[model samples]
Target: MEVRAQLASVFHLDKCLGCHTCSVVCKNLWTDRKGSEHMWWNNVETRPGTGYPPLWEDQQRHHGGWVLAGGELRLRLGSRPHVLDQLFQPPTLPTLDDQYEPWTYRYGDLLGADPTKDLPTARPVSAITGRPIDPSAGPNWDDDLGGSAVHAAADPNLAALDPDERQALLAFDRLVFFHLPRTCNHCLNPACAAACPSGAIYKRGEDGIVVLAKERCRGWRMCVPACPYKKTFHSWLEGKSEKCIGCYPRLESGDAPACFHACTGRIRYQGVLLYDADAAARAARAPDERLVDAFRDALLDPADPDVAAEAARAGLGEAVLAAARRSPVDRFVRDWELALPLHPEFRTLPMVFYVPPLSPVRAVRSDGARPVSDDLLADPAALRIPIRYLASLFAAGNERVVVDALQALAAVRAHRRARTAGDVTAADAARLLLEAGLDEATADAIHRLTVFPTLRERVVHPPLAREGEADRDPGIQGLVGLRRRVTS
Candidate 1:
């Protein structure tokens, strides 16, 4: 059990209100530079839509991640020969057309305009070019427009649904979308790191945060198409590949990433996760349906005496172990089984997990009115959003797991509502909660973590010994601190 620590994240989709505060703050802080107009390091994509890069989940087009070849794992993108050929001319790479040509308003027209008969209007112009733009698409262009056949119909996840289900999913009233805020997963099995021919990308040993060295980068766009999540992007202006660093600089100083800090919904949770290095390959190689469970199996119990001994032997400091024990991410993902990784079939072993949203049961709620289906509030029927759709996103097409998770979430809500709303009897709540394998205490705990986590509660930074880093040579301290591995 070769224990190691990774910086893991959990986003409670249940609490996300589709507010773009996370995106806005991330843009303002990091990707606001030239050649990054279309790059959204943190983006909130609406479900039932094609997402930011337009059909990013269509691995058939992207040809990213890995595949079984001769009973061995190999990059689905290609081997070295194919990679060299596709370097300068990456046909599979997403162009500005796919991820819309970014535009900004000619704000000078509005802010500094001469008095005229017509209203002072700012025309939308290409952020890249000085010419006027039509503003055809944007980061959240498909937001709340899941009913549009042009947008939602093109969703790749819809492939899992039958023709009839697909049609209904695109229907106006049937369209109930959820927010999927995405960033670089900083995967345990990082395909981007492996695909970078320049070997610029490397995962930190201490925290598992994947980083790309600008100087070593050879300007090859291979990593872009190779990342299944499309998190890696080439900056035309900088001649380098860039991605979310998980705000490592801030993290070393005991601060959360800008997006996590600025999140209005308080849906983001960050913490340490202890896991076995030996399990990553097997977990990634698991059958698609079992990938989520395999990944969870990779994460060893931090509180386990045997696991703790392995951690100590593997050089994990006491502080990290403590953080792992207290990790809400561990509770949500492993203990309570409330959260799941997105697109586990991608096989990148993404560190970030999501607590799937529980859509409101289809019913009217008036004063002294009873719910149409008490089973929905207690037993969790696919009332608003189809369970199959969510299963595609999170469970690698495992509807059974999605059903169980949704049922568990519903049980928590039912337990709470009975006490607060008197909509159901205590017996009803207890029965449902028991059916879902939860008690009131556990339900309350899950509810608190999902809804009202404080900054300290949400972000649990393991003590990175920075005192000695400060005492190092000031000129090279930054380099020294970064290059220092966990084994060092």
Candidate 2:
């Protein structure tokens, strides 16, 4: 039972005003040099739209991280050194375009001098490519235009529409907004370290912060694709993959990482957590309940005399232990009563935990009367809110699909609870689901289903049953009819 110190970050999204002060400070400190100008060791982007690199959510297209197939977790970067060597080999003239094609739009063109300007007169141009831009193809061209999870949660009337109609309404209303700020998760089970051909990427023994040893690096860029968050960057000047060091120099002096210290929103917190390395490794291998249970047990209680004695004996510092006592991860694990890996299905067992935002639904005017939409009742897509994209970035599973499924399950549970009470308010149900760990966007989708009039009728009962039905008939036909009844 060897105890290892881990560096963990706690972000309070409620406090995050989407200010880029943290990003700017970090860029000035680490990424301002040549060959790193385009690199943002830290960045903030609007979510649901493509991230900076565009479609970063499509992991299948990127071929990064582990995949579960045939009941086994398969590492894409081969386990052998030679295999990693081949995988990491540098490319010729490695440019930002290789990783991300920078793009921007012309907003001024749409606001032309003339009020009645049309077609050619209203067209804008691209800033980077310098081509005549199509307003339809530019960055954030549709920013915040689609119906958001927050909107759906606030207004439950949307749930009754069909998926296609709901999508159209979202596109038309432009209701949702999400802020995604990214940095290295510095994972407990880091794929970048595991995929390293030269073992250059190693987790610090003292802090569990995954770091790339510059000199030890073989210049194989496998870490670029191996990272689910895509935080690792290939440095042409250094000819290696580099990432946030968790500001080790700062941490050594009992200071926070640069980004955390500089954050205007106070969204970041640094602390130590005790974990079972052996159990984490085992989780990386089999990836089942035993592994999940292992994580649940590895939680360290700084106040517990026995746990404190064990930590001190394992060489953990008093300062580290002190911080762990008041850390956010400890609070979330022990008090908040919520546990979700950033992306559990990915099997990387990322330690980062996000407490999902519970967005409020608001009343909307419909047809000159206050008619609530049933968006929360049937369609999961009506939740126009955004879940933290970090889950898909660091977690070891099918990040998007798994999160979506979890949201659906939560919605079902909330709906059932509401039905039991005989007072089913789609908005209330959606709020309940949001509180249960579903992101605003997904919760709103469920809310929309619950509120939609047509969808409510469709989903409240099976297609085979009408008004009159016998309660206690035990015949096969009667059982089928009972199953077909719409109780809600």
lDDT of 1 by residue, 347-389 (tens): 8889999988887554432233445656666545545667778
Model 2 residue-pair collision total:
56
RMSD of each: 4.1, 18.8
Tens digits of per-residue lDDT for model 2, 365-413: 2233332444443333333442223233223322343344435455554
After superposition, the stretches of candidate 1 with alpha carbons farther than 4 Å from their true spots are 108-116, 362-371, 465-488
Instruction: State the local distance difference test value for candidate 1.
Output: 0.80
Question: Distance from true position, residue 99, model 1, in Å?
Answer: 1.4
Taken over the whole model, the C-alpha lDDT of each candidate is 0.80, 0.52
Per-residue error (Å), model 2, residue 164? 4.6
